[model samples]
Target chain A: MAHIELKNIRKSFGLVDVIKGVDLEIFSGEFMVFVGPSGCGKSTLLRLMAGLEDITSGEMSFDGTLVNALAPSRRGIAMVFQSYALYPHMTVYENMAFGMQLAKSSKEAIQERVEKAAELLQITPYLSRLPKQLSGGQRQRVAIGRAIVRDPKVFLFDEPLSNLDAALRVATRLEIAKLHHAMNSATMVYVTHDQVEAMTLADRICVLRDGLVEQVGTPLELYENPQSLFVAGFIGSPKMNFLNGEIASKFGANTIGIRSEHIEIADRDGSWKGKVVHSESLGSDSFVYVDIGMSGDPVIVRQEGTRHHNPDDAISIAPIPGKIYRFDAAGKPLKH
Target chain B: MTLDLWTITKRTAFYALVVFIVFVAVFPFYYAILTSFKSGTDLFRVTYWPVSFSWDNYISVLSTGSFPRNLLNSVFVASVTVLAALFLAITASFALSRVRFRGRSLLLMTILAVSMFPQIAVLAGLFEVIRFLGIYNTPWALIFSYTIFTLPFTVWVLTTFMRDLPIEIEEAAIVDGATPWIIIWRVFLPLLWPALVTTGLLAFIAAWNEFLFALTFTSSNATRTVPVAIALLSGGSQYEIPWGNIMAASVIVTVPLVVLVLIFQRKIISGLTAGGVKG
Candidate 1:
């Protein structure tokens, strides 16, 4: 296991800088996720850590050893790529055993490790099939199994689930969480554009924006006390609603953000008045889009159980007091 | 009834064009085989089909003189040249296509430009080098010269084919602790068979049929390849050429190439069309 640290790391392609400067530390045996919008350099940061891309300038160390110049394999890291990147010509068993085979491990050791990994991923039956013959989900499992056979100090995933369909993405996400628990000694750095994945899977989520670390905290820390407005908005699905102008000024701020579930639909004397614009029901819960005349775009309110909030019906909503997050003009949250 | 007639007319025209093209392409080889089976005055007649089924020319070509030796020389030289060219090209193409260097495109262009020059243009210079190396009048000289000419095409085709390979595969290999050599030998070589077969076959054919260099390089009957041997085929006297013996030798020389193409026919077609689209 390795504790990874990046000090003022920067990456550039020609004159265009993708990762300007970033500093972060990931503990040993921790699942650190890099979550951000596209072009935020989340994937690039993971690549730098994995030694797939050389950091233009900075100090990176794994367990107190400088690893900036080390090759990925030499750094003792195995990466699962978004495309699975399985060797098409090799059978599933061969694909998993390849890393160990390259290391010149003994035949018995390689066979044992490959078989164990295949069984762990429930891919034992498909071991003899080529990568092309397996479905996308199976291919990705083989890719993970390949990484597991390496038993590296660190594991890196670059949007490994993004290529799968919606249902498979969820199933594989659960599998990965179980894997993290099983392989508790290995540190993992995962990169994704999906905040839901970050929230559910990460031990600590590192929110990146425009090549900078917006915030790094536990899922509850990020959800409850976001240090910046960007992290508050980026970490949650249905996006945290921002209220500006006169309403925000009353809270002694330039902007105030509140989550959909934090707002309650009131019968009367609500903090904000609006009309129901649309509603979406998901069996257990329903999200009502209320037009509060905040430039026509609706503020979504998450309600438990199904509530028939029909369109064009008058509605009033109020933020649950302390749940509101206040931010200054520069988007940094004001101290409570 | 009218539609049926039109369909028949179009089908007839298509078949007629196909037959004409096939006859035009195959006539010379067909005539050579026909003449090889004829003896004496019967060979002079422009017959569309065989007049006799005689084995005299075949027996003489195989049993007498250094014809069999020359055939062996051609096989040895072509096979070695194809193997050598493919080995060098596969390695060179990995660098040209995968590894980024400052003047890669310029280097590739120079290689292609080298192939553009006529063989005769470099004949004198190559002769000096061949003599300097002291491989003059040997199969090594022919193998060396053929590799020089074939490397450019093989490398160019292999480079394009190698470029289309997913970089992710190579990266995965790297992460698996594969050295560049291992990647080439284990990972890439398997995937590269179609392109290799295609390029190797073309190089084999080129070396097998190459007459100018073979004629200029080797002097002895034992060292001479089939093309030169066929060219230097002697008749009973100085005035009359042994046309039948020459035809029999030509058919013998061409058979191996036909067999090779037939065996790798599918791979060659796929390899030729490889870079044209994603496989």
Candidate 2:
């Protein structure tokens, strides 16, 4: 419902700055995810946007109106905490109804909104049950339902799926995606350390490191052309293996980078030779860890399914020429 | 066979130790009740039970002595003390436990010091202050005095309970547009029922059994609490100690507290243990 803009926002606890000066703009209805490791200030950035924390310096504008002094409720935002934060003493219905009650909405309106939310969340059967009685997944739904009843301009989720088990997290993640589609007008900002959730849920992922934005781009864009080694290593699982090597040959100043999946594995005839250190088979694809002599690091090559490779096997690998990414010594991406 | 014998001996020793501890803890109260039932001459007779049963002690203690009035006084003081102490302590503890503000640690330390100061150390100064305030012989004097002993412990104990509450619940309320006050009143207070009851009961017992302040402050039957009145009931003239009337009055005063303890014994133990361990 609103585009949120943060201009040079900064925060500090005494002298220790947790959030350095950073600027970001979340367009209307965008599903923006802030992803970083623990203590990297991702959660703090989300909290700052939600008005849960004060912006020490800078301007936060909602829909082009400066809302730096606005209270969280007045800002028309709802946050679902990582803990699910359901009211243990209240039933699911009351938990969802709480915000409307505080806003002094009519009883019929509160009931209508709550029931609609409960139904949308498939939690109608659990409306009368207390939070303690519900399982973690159900409690998460109730927390989401509570946020939905507010019908705010933006929804803030602080690692909302972190507490759920693997299966439940997947289910809840899908539910959130559907919910966003249903409420297409509302802007949503989610923070998570889980890269898969970030990749799957975000319209654009904001990769952060040490209180600074490392890169902000579409998931595939960040994946295919990461600006820095930090983003390169961070965005993927079985993290992209980094091999230290001289340029050997370069076209002008461009430094080449190659991903594991693009490297060709052959029985013989390749640019690089190494003994296979390890191999992981996933049935659909396999990863071959090759120890190139004196490279001081193993290059992980992703091979197509049915490739036969094992540890201690001699192998030849080479980058699929055009697939390599080139970067400068400063880690800036260079044109091919 | 040897292992079985060793295990049997270990079990027997454990039971024996438990019995010994229980007897040591309970025997004094038992002796007090037994002494209260006996006649003055029979009190020193080295007997556990009364030789002759008599309702005369109960009758005299209830009608002719200050025991009845003092029992009523103690009830009023304890009830008022518990109500006021819990009312302020709950709110104060919630603030101390949940809120972030300047001087919060200092405020907590000051409250903790109130509970730590010996009652005897403050007796003379408090007596003068109470007299100067012109509430010396009144229930208000005892009520205020009892708060000194109850509030700090109440706040400290309830703070531990409040801290153990899930922080997310409070944050949920905040996101629901609840101000700090509403969060404390609607969310935190309801969840704190168990802690409140535990603290209130402890405060009541503390106020009810308090003797030094009550004895020093109140001189007349009108305002003297149960303990002082019971101590003063020695045949009305102090020449002969009226053991029977004392015993009957003591039994009357103690029965309610004993029953309360029995009812909430588990909770009391848990609350105390939580305080000790958490602190």
Candidate 3:
């Protein structure tokens, strides 16, 4: 494990700047996740840390030692790409053992490490098989296995689960969570646009917007108290609803952010009232979209269980106590 | 059911077209095989089918002055040319395709432009360079020239194929502690076998069939390649050309290429069209 710090790091491709200036410190053995919408420079930031992309200007140090000029391998970082990126011609064993073999490790050591990684990933049975023979999920495991055998100080995942089916994504996500617990000492920085993955997997989530750090906190901290309107919306699934104009002005704010689950279906005295426009019953929860006549568009209110409301049915909704978030004119959160 | 007259006519015409095309393409090689096995007056006759069978022409061509030596010279030159071109192209294409840099497209376009120049336009200039290098009349002359000539096509094709390789694979290799050279040899090279095979075979065929430079560069039979030797195969006098011996030599030279292409026919076809469509 290493302490990674980026001081005012900036990355640009000629004219268009991707990562403007980001300063972040990742603690030893920290599971730091970078999450944002597409093109927010989250992947670029990850690449900068992995030494894949050169930082335009800044100090990047691992464990108090500057690693700006170090090659990727020398930096002791292993990255799992969105695409598995396994050597297509090589068998799973060779793919996993390639890095060690390049370092000229002994044959026995190489095999031992490879088999260990394979066992950890439950891919020992497929070690002798070429990448083409494996399915998408298996191939990703092999890719991760390849990374594991390296035993790097830092483990970087660039959306490793993005390329799988829904069922496989869930299965692999669980496996990754277990993997983090299994390798607690290795600092991991994962980059993904999926906030659910960010919420579930991250110890501390860094929300990026336009190459800048919008906010960095634990998943719940971001959910409960977002510093910016972007984070308030980006950190939650079904998205945090924003009400503006008269409804927000009533609270002396430009916009008010409320998470779907945080809003309740009121019995009689409710802050907002509207007819149910659309609803999705996902067994455990029902996401009912209400056409509340607020300045904002239809509000998505999460209700427990299935099929609680239908279209043309009237309902009153209100946020739970002081759970609603207020934001001013500049999208900066306004604390009451 | 009885076949319709129109269907029968269309089928007959299609078969006739196919026969014509095959005959047009294969008649010369077929005739060479036939002529290679004939002796004496039969060489004069216009025989489509084998009227006589004799190994006399083959024996003469093989045993006669320096044909075997010329064959060896051709082999050495072509193999060297193909190997040199492919080795250089593999590394160059890796950089040109995989590594982004300033003026990459400009550089690639310049290479494409250089290859488009007519070979005859540079024949004199190339001859001078060959002589200046002191490789003229040696197999080195042909090898050097052919490698330079083949580099553009090989580089272009290989670069296209190399570009198609997923970038993440290269990044993964980088994280795995592979230098560019290691990645090329171990990672990109293996995935690129089919493309290499295709380009390598094409380069071999080009080097093997090359004649203008070969004839101009070498004066002695020992240094001359098979194509030049075959062209210069003559009888006692100027008027009398050894057609049978030429055909026999042609047959011998062509068999190896035919076998090579046949063996790697799949790879070459795929290689030639590899970058045209997404894999």
Q: For model 2, what fraction of the real interface contacts is kept?
A: 0.38
User: For candidate 1, lDDT tens digit of each residue in B215-262?
Assistant: 999999999999999999999889989998999999999999999999
Model 2 Cα lDDT, one tens digit per residue, B153-235: 99898888888887767776877899988888888777777788788888999999999999999878888999988887777
Model 1 misplaced regions, further than 4 Å: B1-8, B268-279
Error of 3 at B249 (Å): 1.2
**Per-residue lDDT over A1-336 for candidate 1, one digit per residue giving the tens place of the 0 to 100 score:** 899999999999889899989999999999999999999999999989878788899999999999999988899999998888787778888989989988889999999999999999999999998877778888889999999999999999999999889999999999999999999999999999999999999999999998999899999999999999999888888999998988899999999899999999885454788899899999889999998988735798999998898899998898897988999999999998
User: Across residues A1-336, which tens digit of lDDT does each residue of candidate 3 receive?
Assistant: 999999999999899999999999999999999999899999999999889999899999999999999999999999999888887777889989999999999999999999999999999999898777788898889988998999999999999888889999999999999999999999999999999999999999999999999999999999888999888888788988999988889888999888898898886554687899988999999999999875456899998888667798988888897887899999998879
Candidate 3: residue A262 Cα off by (Å): 3.0
Best by lDDT: 1
Each model's backbone clash number: 0, 4, 0
| lDDT tens per residue, model 2, A1-99 | 999998999989889898998889899999999999999999999988878788899999999999998888888999998888777667888889989
- lDDT ranking, high to low: 1, 3, 2
How well is each residue in B152-211 modelled by candidate 3, as lDDT tens digits?
999999999899888888898899899999989988887788888989999999999999
Q: What is the lDDT of residue B109 in candidate 2?
A: 92
Taking all chains together, the TM-score of candidate 1 against the true structure is 0.95
TM-score of each: 0.95, 0.92, 0.96
